[model samples]
Target: MSASSTPAPQAEGQRRTRRRTLALCALPVVLLLVVALFAPLPYSLAQPGETANVLGRRDGKPVIAVEGAQAQGRDKGRLMSVTIAATQPEATVRLPDVVRSWFREDRAVMPREAVYPGGGDTKDAEKRISEEMKDSQHKAVTAALRQLHRSPKDIHVKLRLGDVGGPSAGLFFALGIVDKLDGDGAGGGLTGGRTVAGTGTIDADGKVGAVGGVPLKTQAARRDGATFFLLPKSQCGEASAELPSGLRLVPVGSLQGALDALKGIRTHGKVPSC
Candidate 1:
């Protein structure tokens, strides 16, 4: 072959090799972008939500006020409810967002099935949460009245938890009711001028049941300046592992146990710890 023709062929071959190498390198990047934009992840992200004061008012109404009983005492400390911010099943979560959430300390990456069971829609999830909240309120009122040895007919307990939905606030709801009805009396009110945050599902029998998102709840509590956190005995380990510094975790199996712990806090008595 002639030298000029040979040089042209060699140059063309080098160009083809470079093009192939470039295409191979670009393939992974293109695939990653496509997956990050189009592919939906089966997981959801949960973050810490704000803490609400159960003893305070929401939208101009007392959250836990009684009509018959005299609700006295200044705002000594807060009775807060911890909440978790989560994604709905119907929402699209890309891979990049999931990866980012996984690395964020304040965010928790969990299976979508774990957050929304049965693959239900947002409306279905809201309905379930509303029902759970109503059930929790009823159980909380009953438990508080029973603990106070008061008849439901004698006392009218009105809970004004506006727009907040979940059974996790049950424990705090009961405590708020008791605090309002008891009016800072000895053995009646237990807040003791200290901020208290808690989460659990309560029953009319005063049994405390475990709830999800304890770690996120704890973070919320800590951010809200809570000194103590009350939770179910079953969730102690998980909560303890993620509990922030300067916050104490107290485990209770029953409403009475919770009251006792609060009483101990007030009187500087020995309190149960997780």
Candidate 2:
């Protein structure tokens, strides 16, 4: 209205113009940050993966079956083997995904090389994993036979699972074989009608070996309704990092140890734990 009032409104308009300009000037920087956040990194994101019951059927067939032996418990309670769903070595991982996964208790971020040892050649990585899976299966059969004091040449065991590859299934593979053959040694199923899960590598000597990504596998087990986990004694600490509710860890270092623990669980006897 007055000249003074006119100057005040003019100044206010100028201030608004400057603020808008500043925001416009900062837009590129914000966009750059967003782009960087979404850009690919050399890491892999992982979470709970698939679970298979060793003592049960998949696709209408036995997961673990033994020939030329008095097999038992093919329909017994579940012996679940857990896996992780991880970004493959060939897949792209973003920074923002990594940052968010870092704070998540149920998730994991892994070095791409760790998931695939040679890194860039995804085909080679997959081949290696497949080879490891085959080797683990062979070793599991040998270990199970040895545990039962049976000769490998005289016995035949078959293991099958679709598209899953890793040595981590060795422990469960062996257990499943043992369950089908011997069970709990008292005419009872090894799992005692309870759902159990685990992951570990195994040697022909029956020694259980550590498999990385225990936390993720543990989560997978819990998600698949497993109440007991057969843990490699060495992975006790890792499995405890984000243990799920109602899941129990049974620490085992050998096939015999795992059998004993399962027996204890079935009979409500004392069992060693992590």
Model 1 clashing residue pairs (backbone): none
Instruction: Determine which window of 10 residues in candidate 2 has minimal summed lDDT.
Output: 1-10
Per-candidate TM-score against the hidden true structure: 0.84, 0.85
Can you write out model 2's per-residue Cα lDDT over 1-274, one digit (the tens) per residue?
5554356888999999999999999999999999888888888888899999988788888888777878755335899999888876767788878889999988899888777777656688779999999999999999998898998777888898878898999999999898888887767788888898998899999999998789988889988899999989988998987899999999999988988998888889989888
Candidate 1 on 1-274: residue-level lDDT in tens? 6555356888999999999999999999999898777799888889998788988888888887787766654547789998888988788888788878878778998888877666788999888888989999999999988988989998898887777788888988888887887745753446778898999989998999998889999999999899999999999999987778989999999988988898888778988999
Instruction: Please give the TM-score that candidate 1 achieves against the real structure.
Output: 0.84
- Candidate 2 lDDT (Cα, whole model)? 0.87
The best candidate in terms of TM-score: 2
Give me candidate 2's TM-score against the actual structure. Answer: 0.85
